[model samples]
Target: MSQKDSNILDLLKGNLVKGDKDFELTDEECIGFYFSAMWCPPCRGFTPKLVSFYNKVKCQGEKFEIIFMSGDFDEETFHEYYAEMPWAALKFDLSSIKDTISEKFNIIGIPNLVIVDKAGNLITTNGRGAVLKQFGETVSLTWT
Candidate 1:
């Protein structure tokens, strides 16, 4: 892997939380980095749809994962927002790492979803549109 890929792996391997417990990504082939915030109106509208999509894909046994990258202003709001998500998140304390990830992905707006593969290859930066269009299985098949 290139140095940038190595850095991405290292950043992802750090602390992650799912619900109230610690969690880790294993053999998932497709990973979605969801850039969102609790305070953003668009993010608020999209989060539930993403949650439903996440559950649907997982129920169908898709080898996909999502990491919630919060743009929330504080820990309390972050946790409040994260609690509603079923997928894993970069730990609330790792705000700097979250910022680095946002910069790496060139996330310019709320409610963006950047899809990547296991080897840190870009799948699609317009993941939000894919999800919005409900291209769950069809799009997921391309990731692997």
Candidate 2:
């Protein structure tokens, strides 16, 4: 997939961190914005499930990536929460960008997962549901 989505790229580029290294988006077919927080019990419950699904799809060689967007109250909390994720996350300092993404996606609650195609166009807002129900057995194919 080509990095044709400039807006989306701008929103995410240079702001992703995975473990101790800087992360970059690859030529993936799509990207998933996982809006969640450490304080939300529901988010805590769903995050691991999503991470498992993410890892499973990755192991299957799926060309997709998930970027965690924290809803935490502070950077420390965001960092602490993000550390458990296997995928990359938005920068803790770029809180406005996170809010922009959340508003753009019309996210009214935590544990919202939105998928966007390579062109930066939204593919689905019910990503959590899709991963859990629609494509539980073949989660990777859900993006394709």
Candidate 3:
């Protein structure tokens, strides 16, 4: 693995979650950092679409995962919003980690989807667009 990729995985330590269980990032072909908040209407609207894409990928046995970086006001709100997602999330207490990620990706807005390949090279910061265009086609062409 590249240094960048290794660093990202290290940075995410102790902050990942899947369902009610803690999970680790391992062997994903690609990763998506979804920056969003429950209070944001646009974020709420886009989340389900992302979820649909997530489900489709899972059903097809794609090696991908999305990690939510919550911008919610509190941990309770973050947990409530996270419960609705089918993907993993960064814990709310890890605000510094979230902020670092956001700044690293130049995320200035909610609902921004930044995707990285297995090697941790950024595939696209406009994952929302990729998700909208050609669904399965996008996965094969752009993500892997």
lDDT of each: 0.83, 0.83, 0.84
lDDT of 2 at 20: 66
Candidate 2, which segments miss by more than 4 Å at Cα?
A: 1-6, 134-138
Task: Give the alpha carbon lDDT tens digit for every residue of 40-137 in model 2.
Answer: 99999998889889898889888888999888989889888988999989888888888778877799998999999877789999998887774347
Q: Candidate 1: global Cα-lDDT? A: 0.83
Candidate 3 residue lDDT tens string, 13-51: 778989888988888998999999999999998898888
Q: For candidate 2, which ten residues in a row score worst on lDDT?
A: 1-10
Minimal lDDT window, size 10, model 1: 135-144
Candidate 3: regions farther than 4 A off: 1-6, 135-144
Over 4 Å off in model 1, which ranges?
1-5, 135-144
Compared to the true structure, candidate 2 yields what TM-score?
0.89
